[model samples]
Target chain A: MDPASILLGGFASGMVLFIVSVGLSVTMGLMGFVNLAHGGFAMLGGYVIVLAMKHWGLSFVPALALAFFAIAAFSVVLERLLYSRLYRAQELDQVLFTIGLVFVMTAAVTLGVGPETQVIRLPDWLRGQTDLGFMTYRTYSLALIVAGTLLVIALWLGFERTRYGARIRAAVDNRRMAQSLGIDVGRLFTVAFALGSGLAAVGGGLGAEILGLDPNYPLRYLVYFLIVVAVGGLGKVTGVFFAAILIGVLDFVLKIYFPKGGTIFIYALTLILLLARPHGLFGKRGT
Target chain B: MDAPHTAAGQLARRHRFQWWELLPWIAAIAAFFAFPTYLAFGTQLLIVILFALSLDLVLGYAGIVTLGHAAFFGAGAYTVGMLASQLGWNEPLSGLLAAAAVAGLIGFVSGLVLLRTHGLTLLMLTLCTMALLEQAANMGAHWTGGFDGIPGLSFDKILGLFSFDVLYFRSQYLYVLAVLLLCFVAVRMLVYSSFGQSLTGVRENLLRMHAVGAPVRARLVAVYTISAALAGVAGGLFTQATGYVNLSVLGLERAAGVMIILILGGYGRLYGAFVGAVAYMVLEHMLAKAYPTAWQLGIGVTLILVALYARNGIIGIGEALLRRLRGGGQA
Candidate 1:
């Protein structure tokens, strides 16, 4: 592969990772709950998209929107029923609970969809390659890059400029202050968790073309996403974005150059980064 | 400090064990030795018990919520398998030593990174380490035998005396039991030592320990390394017992299962890990035999109930019940 192509591929992959991980970062930042089930939500989205498109013959756009909404809805129920109880519990309890949910969701999917690998076929429009001046790129990947960039910008503006975003920021910065100021902190938490889950779902739906849909996909990606969240710094959106891209790019470059030791290379990178900045690349101290 | 002294006082009280307390444990070990003939499943249970005990050393006693404890176990198994198949080291002791050494080194190195972070970060980092190792194992298909796993690895006599036979499950069970006894004693001694107290102190309050001039991080790392070594020993024994080593040993599911075992037995208690392991394996065996596919669902439900209601696990619940029965006349 050309250097440019590798870079582009890295960029595209990073965008997918960023989308998947930012939700986890947000939830961790806002709620201080290490929601390991974030990957489950992503898997749920992937399975939903695959099922909707393949079995129900829904179009990509509708299926993606439906999957996003479905995961968001699921998150609401999860927040009310499970996460509320877990918020004040010890970190281990939260982890165990989320880990349990991972198994349940995985088993549920396996039971419903069987264990076979399901491919989410892209539409004909997304199947073509675009002729750039220097390199030819897949239209869908390029489209994803554009969409991901737009999403990031929108998220940035929403969080930084909007009143609801300020309320969320206030809640995250100081729960008591936010509540004292008459902001509904409980509702903010639910909304934030829902948003996080929804973003993961979106990432899952979009990247299903590349990642593929499988029952074990969530467990596999869970650590990678967490690494992104951890390395980027919890609750720091920009940190997640940069960390995801760095990891995605590094993973791609290493995999292409040293296929045998790609995983070791990734781990080595993480270890180095962690040693240098234990709080992560963008995380603040004590957070 | 006060809590530690109180706990030490409680430990002293518990050490004055009645004849009945000793009888049950002795009978349990005896049954473990002799019960393999009744069912081949008992041998498998023995190995799992060892695995769980190794976990308790770090999790239960040291208060480390490690999700990657299986890394050492898997590494140990792979090391033994690789050594036996490639290097032709049929000596089980040498294999076990090699496994333990390698696992201990990895544990020590990673513990430096892991011990820095508390709670969720440590949990996630350990999981990452395990995941990374599992991927590396999978990627190194030629060396580790990949998904199909390394087979055809056989052992001669364990320590040049005990012959391992596939048909005779009794010998294998005894071999595992002997190793388990040695490990159990060593772990018991370690837990009773000052080092063990330091670990508990670190777990209870790192800041206070640090302020008091205790090397909390070093103690934690040491405990982690020791736990990893024990887990490695268990893994090496597992390979010897089964004549197979697979990548699934290091997988997340196995790690999660170990956590479940810790929960089932009761954390911080030496024998809890053993009880949890036995219960898990027994329940899994029975449930799988009966339900086949949905057995995990049953296990999942059971774990949820245990986490929610039975905070201290099955052993704690049993002890509570026994206490209630003993005090019934007073009430």
Candidate 2:
């Protein structure tokens, strides 16, 4: 593949990764909770979209919306019942609880979907490639880049400018202080979790073209998403984006150039980055 | 081994060595020895018991909550399988050693990276390591046989005498049982030693341990590496027993299942790993047989309940019940 094509693919992949990591970044950044089940939500969203498209005959937009709503609702339930209990618990509890949710979600999907690989057929309009000046790329993929960029902008504005964003930032910085100032910290947490979940669902829908809607895709993407989060630092939105794009470019370059030893390259890069900046590329000290 | 004189210490000592402790071990050994006469289920249980024991080294003793231990185990199994199948290294001891070495290397390298971060970062790091390794293995389908797995793994004799048969699982059970006993003894000795205490110390208070001049990071890395080696041994045994190596060995579900076993047995106790493994396999076997479609739901519900109510695991609950019964008798 040409450099332009690789770059485009990397950009598309990076956007999807950004969507996934942002949710994780916000939750970890805002709350001291390391919610491992965020990946499970992504898995749930992917499976839902695939089912809607293949079995229910729903179009892409409707299916995407449905998946997002479903994941958001599930996030609310998770937040209210289990995550709420875990907020005060240690990191281990958060991990174990989320790990349990992963098992339950994966098993449930397997039972329902029969452990077979399910492919989502993109609509005819979005199926073929469109030729740009530099290179030809899939229309869906280019659309993903546009959508992802818009979402990033929207998220930044909401979190950096909006009143709710101010509350969330306040709560994240100091929960007790936020509560003292009469912010509904509990409600804010739920909303934050829902937003994270919603973002993951949208990422799942968009990245389904590249990753495919496999029963095990969530677990597959988990390491990549986690590397992005770790490399960007735990809870910073800007950090997640920069980390995701860097990783995306690196992953694509390796995969295209050295398919045999791509993983080695990826890991080697991570090691170098981590050794140089343990707190992450843009993460503050003591994080 | 002498009991401390303090009231709390005396109570702890008594609690540690109850008669029921011996009963289960005795019953399990007796049943295992007699398993050849009954059925194949006992042998399967034996494998899982060993796997759980390996996990307990890190989870119970070192207080590390790893979600991807199966990487070591699966790597060991694949290494042994590839060697035995392709290179024709049929000697079980040699295969086991190779497995241990490979797993130890991976463990040592990954531990250096993972042990740097605590809490969620550590968990994610381990998970990433497992995922990366699994993908690498899957992509290298020619050598590792990809997703179809390395099949036709055959062994001539375990120690140049015992022949491995597919149908008759009795000798296999004995073979795994013997290995498990050796490992159990090794782990027990380690736990009772000063090294084990150091590991527990690191787990409890790394800062305090460092303050006291203990090399906390080194000790953690050592334990992690050793635990991975033991897991490799278990993986070798698993491949030998099953006569096949599959990608499922390295799957996320497999790792999660092992974690569930650790949680079920009780963390920080040697016997808990064995009990948890047996309990998990038994529950899975029975539940799958009863309700194949929704067995996972049952397992999920059980895990939730255990996490919510049974903080210490089955072994802890058993100890509490025994204490209650003994106190009632005294009353």
Candidate 3:
């Protein structure tokens, strides 16, 4: 309808994508492991929120928090048991293993909760529209913007400013040298993985309503996540954020204006950009 | 090609033909006349195996990572589906011909652009191509049948002689088997040919290939086209046998399903496609029957285990066992 509504809606869409894809982008960039099953973690987080609210009688915020933390904790186990062993394996191996994980997660969800979409109840205050100056807007979208911005600021600070962040950057830039400098690169990998997985959960929990929580969530949405990573540049936080927003706005605008021709434009943009700039727009050389 | 003579290490690089090579043909022939009741399922598996075989050419032999090969497959299926229903050209052989031509044309055109990229970017490009095609098909709902899918496909008799029988399904199975065998032989020759060797060179070391005067990009595009053509054949056969064409053939799940099958049977091995197809389909049939709702979990778990431990697939495992036995016998 209104251009302003469309723009803000695009912004909200972008933020959720950022929340979903940031973890995937960073981990892939850092470890050189292509985790095709990254969306499976997001699906897990979405289900956690739905499960908590529906069965445990918890509200949205607390249920979402619980989902974020629980999936984060669970991811640590996955990193240790499975992902750690394959850090040095071939990229193809990593892809296959993660795809297998995706399958396992999708099938598990299907069996556990049937094949229907999982829905969570929100507070009455957040259910409907809020009157802005020119037009009414969804209250939840505003909440998402605030939350996503806060998370982005925190991630930027943590990634760019802190000493830990420096060590991670150094390790990513040159792993062997970082190891020689006694950086404990393996331990660094584990921590980075956990952080990414945790962030993924938070994004999934918060954006569940818009993205739709279902057993097929991972398979359905994984391409979008990967698109964010590829178009933004792997392991670059700011790149992922910017690319996600751009992609989100572009996707929404295209879909609203022209429903039949959205994926072509989005996918073609990624392809053309990749060809023109191999390491991504914001990435370093030779990545 | 002359075999390279070297020390003990080089012996492991040699590829001696094994008796297992004949196993698929023998089984194909046996099932040709034997399985009248289960012929339909058997025919489906043949199409799947052929699809995997095409993927193996690009993925296994050429070392290309493709995620949207289903594009060519859907192209072939749609081509044949349209030819039979719309154009009224239902000759089985010509239908296969048209499928291969259309699918091959798409493959060659796309491969030219895609061969310039490598690794994950190439994978994404292939994926995008499929997404675009699928969208086009979805948007052209009036002709392609959109979500409801294109059904009511009926094929003419094989060479105007062998009519498709209802009870036995012998003609259909026989036709599929004959084509599959021909394709297998063609692929076998291609892989062992000089071009295949140079293609492997590009896969192993592109810089060296360039230095040594090999046209690496062209070779890749050629292999990719051949692979697409084979996959197209599978798609055409699929609709002819099933009497329907669904857009799901172009989906991510279908692409991943074939990739999983290729891995299970072992990539790059000639007979690996057959072995992998048989194993994957049989397991799927049995597992789905046992756990209707959760059979996907079984496939997923099997894939995980195979990827992690059995990296070289069943054929590689067999080679290792054979080597170990030989060593023990010598000792």
Candidate 4:
């Protein structure tokens, strides 16, 4: 492929990563919850999308919608039942709990889906390439770039100009103080978590074709999400977007040049970034 | 329950080794002599115990959360594996020491960078370091065997005294037990030392330790190096006992499992490592034998329950029993 095609491919993957990782970044910063199982929700989304498209004969957009809303509803229940209790536990406890949840979800998917890679039938529009005089690009990539840009813009507006977003910010700043001011921090957390999970579902459903859908997807892709969150500064939506693009391009460029060494390059960069800014490139200090 | 710094350290040092404390070792020895068939599992348990003990040092004692400690373990394993497989160095005891030294060097190098961060950053950095190292090992697949991994390692003898028999694991079990005891005692001293006291201080409060002129970074690096060396010894023992070493030693699963063992046994307490490793390995053995296909589910559920409700683990229960018995059932 030409250089431009490779770069666009990287950008498309970056969009997928942004979609999956932004939620983790926001929730981690807001609640300091260290939700390692965010990938679990993403995996569920991939599975949902596959089942919807293959078994139920739903098209792409409707399937994506179903995955998002279904996962969002599931997140509310998980937040109330399990994650809420862990908010008060030690960081070690929270880490282990989420890791455990990842494993549990992995096994559940393995059992449910028979431990094989699931392939989805995308619409012909997605499979077709958009022709240009100089080069051609996958229609899905164009869709992703457009969708990611739109989603980020929408989320930015929501977070910056809405009452719900203000409440989440205030609750994140100081839970007790927010509650004292009659913010209903618990309800706010539940809402924020559900929304984050919903976005992750959308990302997972859309990105499955690029990233692949499998039982072990959660664990395999965990470090990527975390790298984005860490690099972007937890809780900064804009920062996560930039970090996702940076990681995706960096990873793609390295892989194109040195296939076996790309993961190390990305991780080494993340490690160095964290050493320089442990709170993240744009995250608040003292977190 | 909250006091985990100097007071708890002193209490641990002063607590006498009672008969109940000796009971486990006695049973282990008896099992070694009587149940010859179980020696394979027993030796593996002892190796895990050593690994978990190393983790307990950094995690339990220093309050560092590590998801990449398998770096040292894999280093040690690869050290011994490469030595016996390629360099014609077959002295198991010396190989173990060399492994420890190599792992300590790794710890010193990485800890310099990793110790600067804490919490999730520290955890992720360590993990990133592990992935990088594993990749480095993979790059040398010509010698290291990369993803397929290096196997078929054989040792000559233990200090030129005993030869290793493939089928029977008697000598291997005894040697591993002796080393485990030696390392356990050495670590026991290190944890109760003034330096170890400073470590707990850093763990509980870095600023206070630094304010009190405790050399916080140096203390952390020191304990981390020591812990790496001990874990390396475990890896060395594993390589020798199994006559096999692979990249799986460096995988995230082993690192995560070791941490789970420490938590299951109770973090920080020395015997907790011992108890936790034995319990984990035994449970794994039984569960794997029974579940076969779903053992991951079993372990997953157990970890979730432990993190949710039983963070203190078996050692905590033992301590509660001891306290209740001494006070005649009331605090």
- Which model scores highest in TM-score? 3
Model 3: TM-score, first chain = 0.97
- Candidate 2 per-residue lDDT over residues A103-165, each given as its tens digit: 677779888887777676777888799988767898887887888888888988898999988
Off-target runs (Cα >4 Å) in candidate 2 are A47-59, A110-127, A131-135, A170-184, A253-261, B1-4, B8-18, B33-41, B82-88, B109-113, B131-149, B320-331
Model no. 1, DockQ: 0.36
- Best-fitting candidate, measured by lDDT? 4
Worst 10 residues of 1 chain A by lDDT: A89-98
Count the clashes in each prediction: 1, 2, 0, 0
Better candidate by DockQ, 2 or 4: 4
Alpha-carbon deviation at B151 in model 3, angstroms:
0.8
Q: Show where candidate 3 strays beyond 4 Å.
A: B1-19, B165-168
Q: Chain A only: give the TM-score of model 4.
A: 0.95
Please give, for residues A1-287, the per-residue lDDT of candidate 3 as tens digits: 88888888888889999998998887876788889888888889888888888888898888878877888889889989998888887666777789889989999999988899877678887889989877889999988888888989998999899998888888867889989999998888788888788778878877777888888888898889888888888788899999988988898899888887567788778878877877777877763
Pairs of residues clashing in candidate 4? none
Tens digits of per-residue lDDT for model 2, B1-331: 5556687577446434456557656776788666555436776677667777778878777878777899998989998998987888888878989999999999998888778776555665676677677878888888888878987777878789898867876677778778878887788778877899899888788789989999888888898998898888888888887789988888777887777787788878878877788788888889999987767667767776676566678887998999999999999
**Interface CA RMSD of each prediction in angstroms:** 2.5, 3.3, 1.4, 1.4
Q: Positional deviation of A149 in candidate 4, in angstroms?
A: 1.5
lDDT for position B226 in model 1? 90
Model 4 complex DockQ against the native: 0.63
Model 3, B236-283: lDDT tens digits are 988888878988878888898898788788888886788888989999
Q: Which docking band does candidate 2 fall into?
A: acceptable
Best by DockQ: 3
lDDT of 4 by residue, B1-331 (tens): 4447897776765745566767767887999989999898889888999999999999999998989999999999989988887888989989999999999999999999888887668888999988887888887877777877777778987878888867879999999989988898798788778887788888888888878887788888999999999999999999999988887999888898898888888897878888788777887888889977666787778878888877687787788788889899565
Stretches of candidate 4 off by over 4 Å are A173-180, B1-15, B320-331
